[model samples]
Target: MNTYFITGIGTDVGKTVVAAIVTEAMQADYWKPVQAGELQHTDTHSVEELISNSKSVMHEHSYALRTPMSPHAAAAIDGVHIDLEMIEEPETENHLVIEGAGGLLVPLNEQETILDLIKNNYKVIVVSRHYLGSINHTLLTLSELRSRGLEVSGIIFNGKAHPTTEHIIKKMGHVEEIGRIDEEAVIDKQVIKKYAEMFKPRLEAL
Candidate 1:
């Protein structure tokens, strides 16, 4: 079974939305290892709401901190230390979509970062949204994954398209283009379904 690790160039880059679309497309199981905040409406809940697939299973989080801050800081505030060994991936036979918190280098604890959660076998999908320094962020993220000898399945561009930026990233990053999730007015199940269909071909090819 394929395991896709959904990460972003930065926070609010729409990793959860992309995870939902991928999960809907493959009817895969969903998991968010470390959730720093929004426990009431967690990423698992959000993905569950966005996806229409009945086969998808939303797994519980390892660490659900209270503050909407970095995992390390949030865990500190919650009076709990995020343990890497304790954050185990759920055993499943189906394809799994794992969403990470913040960026690739976001600290989970004093020693480990979000990147440490990614296994070598997992297909990493970097969700890149266009911004002032997004190009740099994208390259750095891809580079870091490559440095770790991780398998980067591809990149998913979120929000509006910036042709120049996209071109440079595709050429320089030397990564496959999985496609983009266009900006939407209302990103309901219908929207997620549409993107799922649009990205299914590429995702399957991965």
Candidate 2:
């Protein structure tokens, strides 16, 4: 059972969407360890709704905060501390899809960042969405992962295809282009299933 840790260059880069695709593709269990806000419509709930696979199980978050902010701030507001050691991964026999918040450097606590939550065994998938200055963000993300000696499986581009941006990212980062999620009008279960099928081959290869 492979564990895919889905991260992004920055916030709103579609990590949850890509995580859904990968989870559906692999029929994997889903987990979001530290959700900062939106307790009503959490990432775990969103992925559960998006995926059509019966094999995928939605795991409870390790830390569910009330405020919509970084985990550290949210935890503080709630009068608690996020201990990385206490943030345990759910025990799952199936392939697990772990969606991260914001970006790699986002603080989970005063001492630890989001990067600290990713275990060495998990295959990292950096979700890169094209925007101005995205190239630098993408490269820096990959560089940090490399420097930490984390195993980066590849990148999943999320948004309209930008050949030049994609070209540069692939060439410079030297990471596999696993697959991409094109701009979708409505990302329903059917749409998620479509992208699941499209990404299955490459995901299986990983």
In candidate 2, where is summed lDDT lowest over 10 consecutive residues?
Answer: 84-93
What's the lDDT for candidate 1?
Answer: 0.94
User: How accurate locally is residue 42 in candidate 2, as Cα lDDT from 0 to 100?
Assistant: 92
Off by over 4 Å in 2: none
lDDT of each: 0.94, 0.93
Error of 2 at 126 (Å): 0.5
45-70 in candidate 1: lDDT tens per residue? 99999999799999999999999999
Q: Candidate 2's C-alpha lDDT?
A: 0.93
Cα displacement (Å) at residue 74, model 2 = 0.9
What digit string (tens of lDDT, one per residue) describes model 2 on residues 83-162?
98888899988999999999999998899999998889988999999999999999999999989999789999999999
